[model samples]
Target: MPSEQDLRTKIESGLPDLHNLIVTDISNGCGQSFDVVVISNTFEGKNKLQRSRQINNLLKQEIAQIHAFSCKCYTEAEWSKVVV
Candidate 1:
C-alpha cells in the first residue's frame, strides 16, 4: 500500500537537497508499481547502478511491498540536458 505521495515524501526526506522528483503509479492507482525520477546532487558522481542503489536503499521497505519499481536519477546538469 505504498502511495506515490508517501514514496515522494520519503525520497525528499532522504535526499533533502534533491532538485526534482516525479513519481507515477504505473499500476493504474493500485500502488503496486511505480516509476520514479529524481534529480539531485546525490547522484552527481554515481553511475547508474549506484544511483539506483541509493534510491532503492532509501525506499527499501516500500519497495519490498510493491510489485514493480523503477528509479532514474540524474544530477541537475544531467537533468537539464535530458529534458532540453
Candidate 2:
C-alpha cells in the first residue's frame, strides 16, 4: 500500500504544472483508498468528465492498487471559487 505522501508524489510527477495538489488517505488507516484534489492550469478548457479522465490516465498505476481513488480536478479559476 502506498503512503499518502507517495501517492501525492506520483500525482505531481505525472502531471505537469500541477498546483495545490492535495491527497487524503480515506481508508480509516488502511492506506488503500484516497481522495485527491488537484488544481492546475492544465485542466483549462476541459469539461469535468475530460478532466477526470485525464487524471485517471495519469494515475493508472496507483489506481490499480488502491481500493478506491476519488479525484477532484479543477482549473485555477474554479479552484479559487471552491476554496472560498
Candidate 3:
C-alpha cells in the first residue's frame, strides 16, 4: 500500500502548479478512497466537469488505487469567491 506521503508526492508531481492541494485519506488501510480539494490557475477557464477531468487524467494511475474520490477543484477566482 502506498503511504499518504507517496500519494501526495505523486499528485504534486503530476500537477506541479496546483495550489492549496488538500488530500485526505478516507479509507483506513485500504488505499481506496480519498477526498481532494485543489485550487489552481490551470482551472481558470474550465468548467467544473472539465476541471475534474483534468485532475482525473493526471491521476489516472492513482485512480486505480482509489475506489472513491470526492474532489472539489477550484480556480483562483472561485476560491476567492469562497473566501469573500
Candidate 4:
C-alpha cells in the first residue's frame, strides 16, 4: 500500500520543478483516492487533458491501484491569482 508521503515523493519526483503542489489522500487514510493540486510554469500552454495526461503518465503504476484520482492543475500565474 502506498503511503501519503510515498505518493508525495513520487509526484514531486515525476513533476520536477513543480511549485505549490498539494496531494491529499481523500480516502480517509485508506490511500485509495487522492485529490491533487499542482502549480507549475510547465503547465503554461497545456490544456486540461494534456495536463492530466502528464500527471497520469508519471503516476501510472501508483494510479493503477487507487480507487479514484482527481487533479487540479494550474500555471504559476494562475495559481497566484486563485490563491490570493
Q: Rank the candidates by TM-score, best first.
A: 1, 4, 2, 3
lDDT of 2 by residue, 1-84 (tens): 777888788778888888789889999878899999999999999898999999888778878888998999998889999889
| Backbone clashes, candidate 1 | 0
Alpha-carbon lDDT, every model: 0.94, 0.87, 0.78, 0.86
Which digits, one per residue and each the tens of the lDDT, describe model 3 over residues 4-75?
Answer: 666677767777567778888889857778888888888877888998897888777777776787789987
Each model's Cα RMSD: 0.7, 1.1, 1.9, 1.1
Q: In model 4, how large is the Cα lDDT of residue 55?
A: 88
Candidate 3 colliding pairs: none
TM value for model 3: 0.81
Q: How do the residues 20-82 of candidate 4 rate in per-residue lDDT, one tens digit apiece? A: 788899899999999989888888889999999998887888899899999889999998899
Q: State which candidate has the highest TM-score.
A: 1
Candidate 4: C-alpha RMSD to true structure equals 1.1
Better of 2 and 3 by lDDT: 2
* Cα-based TM-score, every candidate: 0.96, 0.91, 0.81, 0.92
